[model samples]
Target: MLNFKNIAIRRGNRLLFSKASFIIHKGQKIGLTGANGVGKSSFFALLRGELHSDEGEFSMPPNLEIAHVAQETPALDCTAIDYVLDGDRELRQLQQQLAAAEQAQDGLKQAELHGNLDHIGGYTAQARASRLLNGLGFSTAQEIHPVSSFSGGWRMRLNLAQALMCRSDVLLLDEPTNHLDLDAVIWLQDWLGRYPGTLLLISHDRDFLDAITDHIVHIEQNNAEIYTGNYSDFERMRAEKLSQQQSAFEKQQREIAHIQSFVDRFKAKASKAKQAQSRIKSLERMEIIAQAHVDSPFNFRFPAPKKLPNPLLKIEDADIGYGDKVVIKNASLSITPGDRIGLLGPNGAGKSSLIKVLSGQMRQLNGELHSAESLNIGYFAQHQLEQLRLDESPLWHLQKLDKQASEKDLRNFLGGFDFRGDKVNDPIGPFSGGEKARLVLALLVYQNPNLLLLDEPTNHLDLEMRHALSVALQEYEGALVVVSHDRHLLRSVTDQLLLVANGKLQVFDGDLDDYRLWLAENKKTGDEPAPAAIASPAVRKDERKLEAKRRNTLKPFMDAVKKSEALVDKLQQQQIELESKLADPSLYQEENKESLKTLLAEKSRIDNALHQAEDNWMVAEENLQQAEKSCIN
Candidate 1:
C-alpha cells in the first residue's frame, strides 16, 4: 500500500498540487485523467521520487522498490536484450560473487552457490527477461540489434520493456501507448490488466484507460481527488458531481437574486433595510463552487472552400499498386469536386497505395488515368519526410519550400501546426513523430491545394491534435481523400467512403463504419445472405450501372493490372541495378565518384517508384483475388 499525505507540487511558481492526498493498495490499476497541462505527469513523477513536492509526505511500505517508465525514454545506447538483462543486476552480481568464491580455494563452493542462487531466485532471471522481450514484441534476433539502430519509438519500447523486467513493486507509466500501434497497445492493455503490482497510468486514451484501470484519480485546478472505478466510471461520477454543483450554483443564484430584488425595493425603507443588508453580507461571504472546465472543447471547424472542384481525378479500369503486386485491379474510381472520401481498412489494407494512384505520381497499368486541368494536390505522405531533410532545421525546411517566404510566415504556419516560437528553428532530426506529422499537415495547409490527399493523417497526434485536425479537415472544401483507421476522425470529417477491400476499390454509398459492417455482413464466407436493402438513396439509380461498370471494366482492368505488374518488374530490375552498384565500395573509392553519386540518386528514385509500384501491385492482386473469391473456388 502507498499513501500520499498533504502532497503539494508546483511548476515554476504555479502551484500544480497543494496538499493533495491519495492512497493505493496492491493489485489496483489507477488511471490519471485531467485536461492537457493539468500536471498528471508531474504527480506520477512525484510518486516515483523523480520530482519533489514542495510540501508533502509520500509514504509507502518502507524502502519499497519502485520503477518509473517515463512517457519519453531517456537516451540509452545498448542492445535491447543486454539492457533488459541488466534488470537482473542483483542476480548477476550474486552469480559473479559465487563464481569468484568457487575459484578462491574451494570446489565444494559450487554446491553452496546453488543455495545462494535459489535464495535470490537467480535461476529465473533469464527466463523472465526472455518472456518480457517476447511480450513487448521483441524476438531473440531483435534483442541483439543495436539500440542505436532503432527509431525513437522503438527505443521507448525498449525502455518500457526494461522497466517491466525489473519487477518493480510499483509501476508508474506516462502515456504508455504513445509509441505503440493499435495491436501493441491492445497487447499492453491485456498485460497491465492482469499485472499484480500497483499500477498508475497517465493517459488520454479513453478506451485504453477505461478497459484496464479500476480506479481514476483526477487532478483538476491544483487539487487531486480519487474516484473509485475506471475512466468511464469516473466520467459518469464527475458528471454527476458537476451537475450537483450546477444545481447548487443555480439555487444560490436564485436566492441571491431574490434577496437583491428585496434589497433594491426595501433599501429606501427603514424597517426592511437591516434584513436585506444581512442577506447581502451572507452572499458576499459565501465561497462560490469552482467552475471546472470539465467539458472538453471540441469546437472543431473546417475552412469553407473558395470554390468547389469541377472534377479532380478520373480513373477507368485502373490497376494501381506497388511494383509487381497490384492492389486495385480493374477498378474505375472517380473523384468529383467537394467529395470527402474516407479510405479505410486494416493496416496494410492498401488505402495509402490507392491514394498514390490517384495522386498521378503513380501510373496505372492497362488504363489511362487523367487529372482535370490545373489540378492542385496537397499530399500528406504516409511515410512522411518526402519533403523533409533529416539534417535541415524547420526554418531551412520553410526556405526550401519558398525562398521568398519570410521567417514570420514560417513561424505562423508552424505555430498553426502546434510547433511554437523556438521550436520552429529546431532541427527536424530530433522532432517527435507527432511533431513531424503536424509539420507535414502544416506544410500542406500553407500550400492551399484544392485536392487534399491525406494518408493516415492522425497516426501520431494526441486526442487534442486529432480533434483539431478533424475540425480543420471538416471545413476543407476541395476534393478530400483520406486514408485512416480512426473511426471517430473518419466519422466526423467524411460522409462518403472509398473502401479498398481485398483487391477491389469499393465506392461505398455510406460512411466508413457502415461500409465496414456491410463488408462483414456480405463478405463472410459460407453464410451468403440476400443483399440488404439500400438505406442510402443517393446511389440507387447507379446500382445496376455501377455493377455493369464493375463487370465491363474488369477485363481491361485485369489487363491493366497485368501491365502494372510488368512495370513493377521493370522497377525491380532497376532496383537490382542500383543494389549491384551500391554493393561495391570500390566504385566510390575511384577517381570522380560521379558514377557512385549518380547510382545513389538513381537508387533513391527507383526505391520510391518501386514503393509506389508495390502499392499498385497489391491493389491488382487484391482485385484479382476478390474476383476469384466472388466466384466458386
Candidate 2:
C-alpha cells in the first residue's frame, strides 16, 4: 500500500496542492486529475521518487517495482520487440546470468537459471511483447523494424508498450492514450482493466478514466482530495460538495438552465431526432456534473457562422491520400450547416487524410469536391499547434484574425479561454501544449467559420477545458467533423459516425458502444473491415449473393494468410530468443568457442527459416489482397 499523510507539493515557489492525505492501497486503480499545471505530473514524480513532498510524509512498500512510460525514446538499432523486452529487467538479468553459466560450462547453474526463467515465464516474453505491440496498433511487419525507423508518435507508443511489458507492482501512466487512436485507446483500456497492480493514471479523457479507475484524487484550490468510485462518481460527490457554496450553486443553476434551454428548444424537433435525444441525455448528465465544473477557468463558445450554407462541402467519388498513393478510395461525403460527424477507424486507416482533404489542406486525387463560396473552414489538428506564432501573445494572435476588433474585445474573448492579465500579452513560446491548444481553439472560434474540422482536438486539453469544448460544440451552428479518442466528447458532440476502414468510407449505423462491439468482431476475424453500408432495396439481393460468394472464395486465401502469419510469428519469437542469447558478451569468450559456434549455426538456420516464413507471409497477404480486389471489382 502507498500512504500520503498531509502531503504538500511545491514547484518553485508555487504551492500546487497541500494537505493531500490519501492512502492508495495495493491493486487499486487511482486517477490523478486537476487543471493543467496543478502538479499532477509532480505527483507522479513524487511517486517515482524523482521529487519529495515539501511537507508531511509519503510512504510505500520498499523495493516496489514501478513502471512508467518514458518521456523520450532513444533512437536505437534494436528491434521494437527487443526494446519492449528490455522492460523486464529481471528476465534480462536472468538471461545474462544464464549466458555466463553456459559459457562457463556450469550445467548445474544453467539448469537452475533455466528453471528460474521458466518460473517467471521468461520463455514467452517475446510473445507477450508482441501481443502488447499488436494491441497498441503496431502491425506484425512494423514490429520487426528497428526503433530508429519509427516517427516520434510511434516511438511514444513503443515507450508505452515497454512500460506495459514490465511486470511491476505499480504502474504510472500519464496520458498513455494521447498517442493512441480510438481503437488502440479501447484496447489499452481493456488491458489496464486486467492489470494486476496498483495503477496511478493521469488522463484528460473522461470516458477512459471512468472506465479504468475506481478512485479519483482531484487537486483544486491548493488542496488534494480523494473520492471513492470512478470519475463520474467523483463528479457527483464533488458537485454535491460544491453546491453547498452559494456562488457555486448559482453558477451551477445557470449552467443547468442553459443546457435545459437547449434541450427544451430541440426536444420537440423531429428533424433533430438523434441530436435531440443526445442533448436530452447530456442535459440529464449536466444536472449532476455541471456543478463540478462551476469553477472551471474555461468558458467559451463558437460564435454563429456568418453564413449557413446548405452544403458547406461535398465530395463525390473522391480518392484522398498523398500524391499518387490513395489512402481512401471512392469516398463520398456531404457536410451541411449542422452536420456533426465523428470519424472512427483503426490507426493508419486515413481518417486524418480524409480530414485534410475536406479542409483543402490536401486536394482529392480524383472526383469532384464542391465547396460553397461562403464556406469558411476552421480546421484544428495537432500540426496547427506548431503553426502558432510562438513569439506572439494570445492577444496578437486574435488581432491577426480581426484587425478591426478592439483590444478590449479581443482580451475579453481570450479571457474566456483562461488567458487573462499578463497572459494575454505574454509570449506563448513557453506555454504548455494545453495552453497553446486553447489559444488555437480561441483563434478558430473567433473566425465564426461555417465548417469545423477537428482531428484529436482534445489531445492536450484537460478535463475542464474538454468539458468546456464539448459544451461549446453543442451550441455550435456549423458543421463539425472530428476524429478523437475521447469517447465522451464524441458522444456529446457528434450525431453521425463515419467508418473509415478497409479502404472504404461508409456510414456506421451505431453508437460508440456498437463501435466497440464491431471492433471486437473485427479483431476476431483478423481483418480491419468496416461494416457494410446499408444497401438499397434494388441491390440488396444481388449484394448479399455476391458477398456470400466473396466470403467463400476469400476463405482459402484468408486461411493461408492466417497460417503464414502464425508461422512468421513463431519464427520471429524464436529469432528474438536466440538474439537475446547471442547478445551476451560471454558468448564471444574463447573458452566457450564450441558453444558459440553451435549458437551461431542455430542463429543462421533460424534466420533462414524466418526469412522464408516472412516471404511466404508476404505472398499470402498479396494473394488475399488480390482476391479482395477481384471480389470488389
Winning model by TM-score: 2
Q: Which ten residues in a row have the lowest lDDT in candidate 1?
A: 285-294
Give the clashing residue pairs of candidate 2, or none.
Answer: none
Candidate 2 TM-score over all chains jointly: 0.90
Candidate 2 structure quality by residue, lDDT tens digits, 1-633? 999999999989999999888899999999999998888999999999999999999999899999999999999999998999999999999999988997997754665675577668786687699889989998766777999999999999999999999999999999999999999999999999999999999999998999999999998889999999999999999998999999989998999898777666655652543443654675568777788899988889888888897888999998887866667889999888888899999887799999998998988889999999998999999999999998889999898889999999989999999999999999999999999999999998888888999999999999999999988998888899999999989887777888997777898777787789889998888544546456687676775676677788899999998898898779767866766676566776689878877876786798699778767876786787677656543
TM-score of each: 0.56, 0.90
TM-score of candidate 1 versus the correct structure, residues matched by position: 0.56
Q: Give a tens-digit lDDT track for model 1, residues 1-633.
A: 978889888899988877788888887999887755678878877777778879878877776668776355545677777677666556667678767965783323533554555555554465467567655656445666777777776878887887777657788888777656443554577678877888888775656776889998888778888999976577566655665676645644554464355335433542332223443343232222111222333222334445555677888887776777766677776788767677754334467677777776677766877787767888887467545777777767777779898888667666666667787777788776667776777767766778888876776566556655754664566888886545455555555655565566665444433444554564333122223333356665565566555555456556756787698779766665555455554664657378766765776698699778866765765665466445311
After the best TM-score superposition of candidate 1, give how far the Cα of residue 557 lies from its true spot, in angstroms: 36
User: lDDT (CA) for every model shown?
Assistant: 0.64, 0.87
Q: What is the lDDT of residue 589 in candidate 1?
A: 61
